[model samples]
Target: MSKQRVLTHIDAAGRPVMVDVSGKAVTARQALAECRVRFPADVAAQLRKSGLRSAKGGIVDAAVIAGTMAVKRTHDLIPFCHPLPIDGIRIAIDWHGERELRIDCMVKTTHRTGVEMEALTGATVAALTVYDMCKALSHAIVIGPAKLVGKRGGKRDVGRVV
Candidate 1:
């Protein structure tokens, strides 16, 4: 025997519907999401020598700014997400290795719904911004595995920042 899991965004008739959060208690919630941007070997070397700046300007700085903005506007972009007043957000873009950049977005809020989507949106948008700014450097640049790393203060709490 197995328990059947119901989709929150779908009604019994199967039409798409937003989840109702009005009855849910408002609480402090946080989510952490991550993404990675990997540059080709040659491009990575060039970036290092030039201090991670493209002709467009500082790559890391731009990603951070874009990610933060995305966190706030997540509701506008995603259909099911509720517009939330963000309590705090931190976007960190750093070198994971010689050729890879890691982007982490942590979002916090006091709301009825969790902020996992917001964090994920922030990290992924930041990665896209990185790719956009560096496209001239190389079309082979890769962005991938945008994922929710952790979340807390909801029906189910999971993971933690170490």
Candidate 2:
């Protein structure tokens, strides 16, 4: 018989609770998350014409910096996330199409818990930063499906090749 997968963030009393990782062994962990921003066609044309820059400055460059900061501060933003020393964080922003911007955030740590939340937060915030910077051009920008694309270490690895 297969065992049922129990929710890790819940207590025996059925209350929401943070998972305890104190007894778990520390190991190298990495997670990758992504978000996509879709801008209006005219806005994209203007951005490309400007070499992907806006009056505020380079859009992709600013997103990378904001994503890195989000990775380091994830625990502060999410109540259940454990504070871990991030060994490294890399954020890449690229164009998926003429009107779509893709943001990927990768985070690494040596900790008992995985850094999936950190990676997700990083990507989401970076996408938000892009929207904030480009709002002046149009209010029709769309952001997300923000998601964890990969994760490694802890009990199991998930998504793409680790």
Give the per-residue lDDT digits (tens) of candidate 2, residues 1-162. 988999988899989898889899999999999999999999999988988888899988888888889889998999889998999998888889889999889899999999999999999999999998899999999999999999999888999723
lDDT by residue (tens digit), candidate 1, 1-162? 987888999999999999999999999999999999999999999988989899999988998899999999999999888999999999988889899999999999999999999999999999999999999988999998898899999788888852
RMSD of each: 1.3, 1.2
TM-score of each: 0.96, 0.96
Worst 10 residues of 2 by lDDT: 153-162
> Clashing pairs in model 1?
none
Query: For model 1, what is the alpha-carbon lDDT of residue 13?
Result: 94
Stretches of candidate 1 off by over 4 Å are 1-3
C-alpha RMSD of candidate 1: 1.3
lDDT of every predicted structure (CA atoms): 0.92, 0.91
